[model samples]
Target: MELLIKGGTVVTASGSFEADVAVDGGKIAAIGKNLPVTANQVVDASGRLVLPGALDAHTHMAMPFGGTVSADSYLSGTRAAVCGGVTTIFDYPVQHKGETILGLVNSKKEILERDACCDYAFHCCITDLNGGEILDEMAQAVEEGITSFKCFLVYKKEGMMVDDGTLTRLLLRARELGALINVHAENPDLIDLRTEMYLKEGKTSAWYHYMSRPEFVEAEADKRVVHWASHLETPVYLVHMADKEGLEACIRAKEEGHTVYVETCPQYLEFTCDVYKRPDGRNFVCSPPMKGKESQDALWTALKSGFIDTVATDHCPFQSYEKDWGKDDFTKIPNGCAGVENLYPYMLDAANSGKISFERVVEVCATNVAKIFGCDNKGAIAVGKDADIVIYDKDKDFTISVKNMHSDYDHTIWEGKKLHGYPVQTYLRGKLVYDNGNFVGKPGMGQYVKRSHK
Candidate 1:
């Protein structure tokens, strides 16, 4: 054995038990009670929980939007991910006009290859069909192991919105190619209309940001996506879902046996539209902005009931000054918030507080993401899986502050939030990458993972 972790309660998506794990050649060699293996190194995890490191399936590192780029570069973002017990990240690479799907995806891979601190993959986001040339490249992208794509239903002015005709073509082709389509569901026409009305009425506060994108704006698109995928008989993924009606739409689709997977972010689970009333509410301006308490509670219920498939952080952060761009007008604010480094901690805290089971935590944060997104070797503590793991002390006390964070951003929506449990050590392919508030990993040590169709 190359390394051994002993005496911890190993939790998987299905169950938990006391066991010892042995790693060799960057993979799990064995798992059992008292393995009795000889190794180059050993870790005693007597009172901690040994679990698979999380895979953040949705993130926007170093992305450009609203005239400013996101705060975290690949180096800083992946570093923060590992510190938060996330060993893998799937970032979205946006396509520009005249760019092929593979071209934009490869460009993103080049950057991650040069600067990322942990393993990474990409979800190609096609903003322009390029006269359907990009559509022709979808199969090639999937053949190259990039099996997932994202399209927005809104953002028409940004040239990112895809019409139903394009979406239908993508969905049908995705079905044929065994690829999955991820939708950012929001009704573009309604959003534009509401925004114009709000601005004209002099309601330019952050609260108006939420008001313009109220539950219906998201629900209408959510139900439309469900209807489209169901009618077409293809599997579809809804990203950053945050509304009660949307949840109900998904549930109905599931009951009807349509393949619909939903992913919600930590922001929706932790905050509400009420945050917009605060002085710094502009910092909370994200698409499908956090809804009322009922929606938040409904999301928690859905998570507990196994209705939701994955929990990912739409980890796009802007600096305070950039966020202040929309202090007087919400539309100019960059629509995102930071959560990659806080995703696991918040869920683990909820589990420790008895809100959810530990196994459920692993299911949503690690196992489900791997299964849904085709990360074959990365999601469990079982033998033959990658030795990407976290040793968590459920009783360890920590407060989330930007002062101790590893990302390039200067502020966090999670600041001052305290947690009772946290990942104290994180390993990537059997190597100690993060330990006790410090990153021991080097930039560009990460590899670009080739993912298969789910």
Candidate 2:
């Protein structure tokens, strides 16, 4: 059915303006002050904001990790995503040892086909760069519609961290293949040393998770990766960066014209290491653990100043039982938090409270993500683009709680936080998928998007 979303400020990365948008055949058919078009549905966006649905460039759904799978399956995760105003999500499906890129990609495709509820794509995670055959795999991965490879500078103990030599080779290969690489940067050696020292002192609480991985650990590793990217002249995206010095390095590179994209999560921006001190502090455990108040302040500043390009959730939630595994040892804790359901309203809350401009919200959470990840038909309310849109009610306020969220997970990190503005209605491909607090998305309704080469 055609949809006419009228009388709202259409927000884009560039700015916002009052306009009427018409949708037909799942694409934005027209946009004007008064779109002289008839439609099966007319959405009264009066007194509201019309936004391009958020395109979360980072997500992990039903991903296997730390002896357990993430709590949300593809269906549940994407349902939460659309309800939160995310119409497109690019998930990370790591290629395990002895697994071919095609094998892993196709396996993930089967699951997404059966369960994903929003438009989806993937970043081919490389855990084994075996015998240089992995270099050729990078090119094949791009042809397979996977244009980005996820690499880790940490996780050495998990046998996931690609050595610097392997990372360099991967960078060189990705550059040649016109693909991009995203790295989880944290110096394992330094982190390991610190963790050992803290343990020796009998510091076993969740707080030690933060102490063991100092800010310098991330900054030094970031610098190393940035240097490698510069040498290879390949673009690299640093995921979930949380340190002031790390932000400085990324900013300096951008000022120098390096193609370094930085991403930070809502958890790091809002919470500090102090959360780890709570009785249930272990629940907040994640890799590149949250830092102090100073680092949180710096991360927020970096985002506002444009050094950080995206605010993704890294939504790899684990239940309380899983968190308990790490209670005896911080390293055993599953490294993730439930966030796909909160990305939209949380950012809206940030904008409403003057932490960021409304335009900045569309930029960081939607537009830039599409551009960076090559989501061609997403990120803006414009002609010929996918009609993935959200009608946000600025006058509404809702308290977030696990009871109302759609994720299959049993807990929430933003529980009880009230969002001043919320998405009253959401549409994916010009179809009503969510309204008020109810979800209407269907399993297998989401299509895998083929991204263009960088």
Candidate 3:
């Protein structure tokens, strides 16, 4: 089938231009003006902005955390992702203690096979670092298309958290195997100590949650990780930077010639500790919790200055009732908030408000994510690239409501916020999945994309 998206401003990394994009057999066949071609389907994108579909490289679906699973399953999460104009998501696969990386990959594949509704890829979480077998398995997992591994520095007792020695070894192994190492850089001991002190003082409010995990903890750990990666000559992607200090560390590392990448989520950009003190504080609980307004301003500046490379949702949804599992104790609350369905809209609103350029929005939300995750054929509206496109209506304005959401979760962190821009249509692999607020494609149409060895 051939589809032509006619008369739209096609946004790309290089520039934006009014062009007609022709799609055939799941790839962009041509992009030009007045193309001499016929198509089975023609999408009149007049007056709208046609850009590459957003790629959310960090997401957790049906993930087990805090003794409860995330509310959004693969089907629900991907459905919401497509509805929000995200074409591809690189989800994390948690490797259990004592399990091989290959085994974890296979298990995640089995889980994804049952429910995913959009294109997907995997990033292996290195939980067990002491086992030498994981080193070889990391190489093989890379060969199997899992090109990135995530290791946490805060969950130290759990297999996912690694000490400095373990982190160094993992970085060396990943560098030698041609893979990227993603770090969840937070000082666990500091956080734990603060938590204990807060509990002893009988102060268990949501605000103290942020108070317990201060910026200096993250900044210290981030600075240390950047130095270690530099020493090992490994590329490090700093995940979910919460504030200015962490962003500065990333900038310093980049200035020092280290291949450091920084990713910030919408929560960091839009919300702050203010949300934690709201009557609905539970909805705002996440690791490296939202910071002060000053931090938010610094993050915005970082985004504009190119110090931040990408804006991922870090979409992890939990039911409101489940938040009580923490039971007035902030430590027990599951760490994550829901936003897979709002990433593009929030960023688009920012663009419309003159906070950033539309080209920069595409770069951070689509191009850079795909490049870092090794999805070479994605993240661009050009000839020979995958036909993953989104037509956004800048004239549209809508307030976010739970009633309009496609995710299984009943609430949104951005509820009631008015958004200026929205996706009018979302196409994946040359097929219309979401059109004008309705899902037009069926399940199983989305392929599991194997990333390139970039």
Candidate 4:
């Protein structure tokens, strides 16, 4: 054995146990109560909780939008991820006009391979069907193990949104190729009309951003996506779900046995539309902006009932100055916030505070993500799996602040939040990358992971 972790409570999506884990050659070699094997390194886990490292399936690093790039590069973003016990991140690489799916995916993979501090993968975004020429490339993308594709139902002005015809084509193609289609569901027409109305009335503060994207705007699109998917008999995933009506649509689809998966972010669970009324409200601006308290409550209930499939951060951050562009007009603000680093910790805190079970946290943050995305070797602590793990101290109290975070952003949406538990160390493929608030991983230490259709 090259390394051994002893005396930790091993927590998984299903259950927890006290066990000793053995690792060799970057893979888990054995797991038992008293291993006879000896290792060069033996760490005492003691009272900590050992878990499979979380997988963040939604993130945007070094991504350009709204005329400026996101604050974090692959290196900085993965550093924050490792600190938060996330071992792998799947970033969406958008296909620009005249760009091939392979071109966008390969380019993004090249950057991540060179600069990422932890493992990474891609969900190729298709924005330019280009007379259906791009549809032919979906098979090649799946062959290369990029089995999921993202499409937008909003952002029509940014040239990223696709019409119902485009979405239907992608859904049908994904079903044939054994891939999954992910969507950002929102009524673009309603949003645009409302924004124009708000601006005409001189009600352009950040609060108006939420008002423009009323629950129905998102719910209507959710219904549309679910309807198309059900009629076509294909699986569709709704990302960053934030409204009660939208979730209800998903629930109805699910109860009727339609394959509609829903993902909600921690922001939607913890904060509501009221955040838009703060002095720094512009910082809270994001597309399909946070909804009412009723929506927040619905999210928590869905998470507990297992109606929600996964919880991933749509982590895209811009500098404070960039956010200031929308101080007077919310339409100009960047459409994302930083949450990749805070994702696992916040979920763990919820479990520690008795809001949810630890097993549920593991399921949403790791197991379900891995299973849904076909990460066969991840999301569990078992023999023959990669030694990607996190040692969490459930009794350790911590406070979140931008100064303590490792992301490149100047602010965090989770800033100054308090938590009762946190990850103390993180291992990536048997190597200790983050330990006690320090980053020991090097650039290019991470590798590109080719994901498959589950």
TM per candidate: 0.99, 0.98, 0.98, 0.99
Off by over 4 Å in 2: none
The residue pairs in collision within model 2 are none
The global C-alpha lDDT for each of the candidates, from Candidate 1 onward, is: 0.93, 0.88, 0.87, 0.92
Question: What clash count goes with each model?
Answer: 0, 0, 1, 0
> How far is 171's C-alpha from truth in model 4 (Å)?
0.4
RMSD to the hidden true structure, all candidates = 0.8, 1.2, 1.2, 0.8
Q: Please provide, for model 3 over 134-214, each residue's C-alpha lDDT reduced to its tens digit, 9 standing for 90 to 100.
A: 887777788888889898998765546878987888888888887888888899999989889999999987888888987
For model 4, residues 252-316, the per-residue Cα lDDT tens digits are 99999998999999999988999999989999888778999999999999999999999999999
Off by over 4 Å in 3: 157-159
* Poorest 10 consecutive residues by lDDT, candidate 1: 445-454
Q: Report the backbone clash tally of model 1.
A: 0
Per-residue error (Å), model 3, residue 203: 0.4
User: Residues 1-454, candidate 2, lDDT per residue (tens digit)?
Assistant: 3889889999888888999999999999999898788889898899899999998888999989999999999889999999999989989988767888888889889988998889999998898966667777778779877899989988889888888888888888888888888999999999889989988888888888888887888889989988888767789999989888888888888888999999998889888989999878888888888888889999888878888899999999999889898887787788889888798788888998999888898999998988888888888998999999999988898998999999888888788888898998889999889999899878888899888886
What RMSD does model 3 have? 1.2
Evaluated at residue 389, the lDDT of candidate 1 is: 93
Off by over 4 Å in 1: none
List model 1 lDDT by residue over 339-453, tens digit each: 9889998999999999999999999999999988899998899889999999999999999999999999989999999999999999999999999999998888788888888
